[model samples]
Target: MTTLSDLLSDPLPSGLGLSDRQWLVLSALPGMGARRLARLACECPVWPDGWLSRLPEQAASALRLWLDHPQRSPFGALFDGLDAWLTADPRNTLLHPDHPAWPALLAQLPDPPGVLWASGDLTALSLPTLAIVGSRRPSREGLHQAHRFGRELAERGWCVVSGLALGVDGAAQEAALNTRGRSIAVLGCGVDVIYPPRHATLYRRLLDEGGLLLSEHPPGTRARPAFFPRRNRIVTGVSLGVLVVEAAEKSGSLVSARLAIEQNRELFALPGSLNNPQARGCLNLIREGAVLTTCVDDILDELGHWAETPGTRSAAPAVPGSDDDDPMLGWLSDVPTPLDALVTLTGQDVTACQLQLLELELEGLATQAAGGWIRLPR
Candidate 1:
């Protein structure tokens, strides 16, 4: 059987050579911005055909001229290292414009990535997908909505797409994974490097569960504020639509929603309390004509006939850690208790208790009350 690992290990055909991969890597450089690269690739004849190979003679002069006068040799050096790094990763496969597996939906975008670096189930890219994105600093309500919608959508056979950030993005991905459904994590950084370091476990689990981790950037690319908006475009471009769970006025999630609108994909917004600051972006989206969604059914209904079609539902399994083994819920009390008191009551150690509390809150098993602690929902 061809496992996802096997697929990832396989190399591209020999015809896909060093220069092509180098070009793709160069095209993905951090400050190299997509529009500028597109312009360069079009205008510089040397760039298209073994361009980097001919660099010493033709392109190097122009590149040096651009670099020296601008006093920006760092970007040029970064590009050189990118080429060397690309050569080292045997698992690295660059999906070109002609690859059959490239999602047709993405091709329609005005600025599609020149290449995609993928790990695990590349085939999943062809599946019908929906992007669920929201605030990195989401409220409790926002987190709940994201998980609920993610789980329900995964149960219905839609592959959840998310940026893998903390809060809403992490919640949605966790929900989909818990349901045994496939999800895709589009990173602002490289696939090999897990950002937010806390998500390292989730990142590894995603690989094992036949999900995918993708980036246009080469391995070793660090996460930066600027990389996110570019990453958002891919999230929106790849999906059938985008759902905004909760977002502040300045949140990156709105960027994905806007891209979805530009892509002409369906857009859904979860309405939140008007006073909650995190709800501001979603409200703005609704006012701008995005569909107001209260439940998963709202989204499925908007998908129209396709929602009812066979083989379109997600393949997620039953939620893990749902049984007695789940340490988080095991420690919760039906009545509110102070954090210090709860720690003594559970006798499970402080850090474990704190993590358990956070997990329980995420799973909707507990709610924060007045003072310092929480109580389980009756």
Candidate 2:
């Protein structure tokens, strides 16, 4: 029986040289999980010789056999599959802990993937990244928030990361692509295998439009029930923070939120109406100290320090000096005005209106009340 583990074994291509080959073999060794591999890395063992002494008998034996007699190793077929998978696409590449291009943020995970199969532009990993994750079944409002944040984040030169699931994940990634911006879809299945089937177009567009596809599993591996939860770790692991658009009380997004907190990544949640079931998880997250995100500025305010690069969008926007400088201020009055009304009055999107309102409130020109926004004596 050719198992998924067997499919995980990779070929030691001459192009990769000896060091890369050792890392690949070690990662494919039986019983050599991420935590164990990470622990071994801490020892600073000298290549093959030092590593063999530290590896378990089973894994060490496998490595020794593979090194001396590659043709006799159990992983021969797996190596063939890996070689075939790489040759199948020029964009496809394997990433390991020692790879110079490996994401530093991902390395900080308690148990980072020992190897990653990736497709598309690896440079996306170098950009300032943020994550957007939420319910597979979400409210229309939740979906809107995802798109808004995704578009805004991408416009601000941020690489949006997500699981590329059906609802919020797809919406966010799609919006980012729509703007010709960068995004990385971290899949639970092989980078080549498109699960959920419905996202096939999205999966293709993600790569076609210059986004990256990442997976821990080898090519041809199928998505398992257990893989999705573990995939969330990588989703948050590579980003500065994660924005959960909406989630039910027991939604899988909470798992991501918890992972984000554990990873020490900033957590942001969009508040929804009390009546909506999908809002519960986000509300609970906010209660537990996640940032209550209402606009892109809210996130930028919190994570601005990470995006201070020269060519990227500034964390702070220029403040409007008067009503003439900002048209939104003209719409504000002593009475509370709803956000939608402000959007309608100012001819701007919800996110832009929210950002302007935030600036106004910061300058004491406006304030949010129970109903909506109110003008204050300046």
Candidate 3:
């Protein structure tokens, strides 16, 4: 029974060097997680050796206690298991912040993972990435929007990075792959452990399609609630920006959006009906200055890559819906006009006129404010 601790170990140092072996030892420390290791490394420029010698009394005591565990010790089975896992496949590779193959943006995270376990093409990480995330249970429209954005962005050569959760996240990444476009799935658990179980097929598909799957945790680790939010940081960390399609007022996606803003990465949110409970989180983001994205242009425009980029991969202005071209929509003015006024002005049945107004509203060309619907700048 190989445990995660063993999988993270590198006892014999056969194919491994001393530095990586030290890192594996650090990984095996029960209480010392990424942040503590990062802090220790920063506090002592010459990590591992120098830092271990001078570790504070309390920290050293904790490490000693962990070493006392029957299953953990001077690395025997742990290292053996690790070597086997590494040599099991050519795609299996582990990276740290110092590695040249590590994603540049990811290395900039406040507490970057010291060990990034991955499978598939590591170079694909160099391509600009856009993250798409939302609630695990999203509305139909939300799912549709996520897939549309994912496919479009991926087709334009941007890699779609997302937590491998269901609903919006899965929809987007799957759509990207369906189009034969590249994507990256950041796992909340080990790259080898399929948390959802149902996504077992999708998980293999991702790697089969040359998509990258990454995790900070070692193989054999199971998904935990805390791990998902922690995983969200990496999703946003590796992306140029994060696009939140739909989330509840108190959803985990909101946490990612805040992390993106804190990380100084661009934030984009898709607006939904005020009546939708799932859309409230995105609505709050829009209120607090996240760019409201209606199409790929909304994102590319904000990133300043739309019109100027030269290649087969640029987005064009969105085509206006035929409903927006109706004469009734032209009757709506920038000023708020009453429904009765609109009905009389358009000389149509109340329902017919309302339907047209709704069409224009969806197009971002009109909005109901003050007393009535008003024309809005597209």
Candidate 4:
């Protein structure tokens, strides 16, 4: 059995062979990626055996003068830091392709991350995963859509995957976790470093509740613009499919959608109002042949052949007789719906809406959430 200590201690087989440590060493290099390794392989069919052994003086993903100066290399110091980071926590894991725990889906990516710094359950990476993503500032309807999709998908035993950002990503992942389902957070920064800071509680919940945080960046690496696109690829690549709840014409979520299409992974999007700017991306995607999703079953039915969605939820039946039963049940959901939004949705005056909500709350049919109110799941 390979242990953490043996991870980087192992040596290469022969002159032309590569060791797992060599793989980690190469991965730690800045700008280094699978494509660069591929290019090197073409030149030296037996790589690292000769010119590719360490950081080269000239390469697409090398900083020859900065870190690989002729006098000294930062490789040893970097490994020392990484080893310290690994030892800091028992849950911390640095996974390479050689590790049996590596996600097989990631290996099929065009340029897979050579290493991942992860925490929590690694086994969740093997489960049927669904990527849920969208704009940072979405409409109430968009938020509701994300929550419903995530909850419903998770109820079916699918592990929800997302970036853990401020909006739809957070809403969806939180909803999935609320269902007591597994989830994976693919971070642009390190797994230990929470990007938004606002999601601190969510981050902690993820680990405590058997969720996982995955990162290509080593611990202490800060978030940057370039890192997100890389993160977006993993979100789509690791999942059986991606569902875009809402995204503007130009948004980071669209990047994931595009990557999903490029990878030939199933892409699903929830259609929003035609007037909504955030819906533009999903509409464009649907026009370009992405699946148009209206309900959880739409996704399950379409991806059933490829995705592993096997879970069930007993629907809560509406109460027998409120005698004065309100028509607002159609507007309520597990996701918080602001009173104003509910009023708009139900075409009712504020006073009447509040009264109905109070009645539902008294009947144990609704509960207050941070935003306003949410229907108790049946």
Clashing pairs in 2: none
Clashes of each: 8, 0, 1, 2
lDDT: worst 10-residue window of model 3: 6-15
lDDT of 4 by residue, 1-378 (tens): 111122122121112234445566666556556656434433434443453454454542343332346236556676777789778877888876555555545534557776788898876765667899999999999999989988987788888999999999999999999999889999999888987999999999999998999998878889998899999888887787899999999988999998987766789998888999999999999999989999988886766432233233223223324432556866555545455345435554344566687788898888766545667755
Name the better of 1 and 3 by TM-score. 3
Tens-digit per-residue lDDT, 150-251, candidate 3: 899877777899988989998999988888878899998989898688788778888888799999888888999889888988999877789999999999
User: How high is the CA lDDT of each candidate model?
Assistant: 0.68, 0.78, 0.72, 0.72
The prediction achieving the highest TM-score against the true structure is 2
TM-score of each: 0.65, 0.77, 0.72, 0.71
Clashes of 3: 1
Output the worst ten-in-a-row residue range by lDDT, candidate 1: 1-10
| Higher-TM-score candidate of 2 and 3 | 2
Error of 4 at 124 (Å): 0.8
What is the per-residue lDDT of model 2 for residues 1-378, given as tens digits with 9 covering 90 to 100?
111121122111111223545666777899988888877765667767888999999999998899799999977887787788888888898887556556655545668887888999887876778899999988889989999999988888888999989999999999999999999999999999998799999899988888999999888889999999999999998787999999999999999999998877889999999999999999999999999999988987776444343264233222335544567777665555555334434445333566688898898888876445667776
Per lDDT, the best of the predicted structures is: 2
63 Cα displacement, candidate 4 (Å): 13
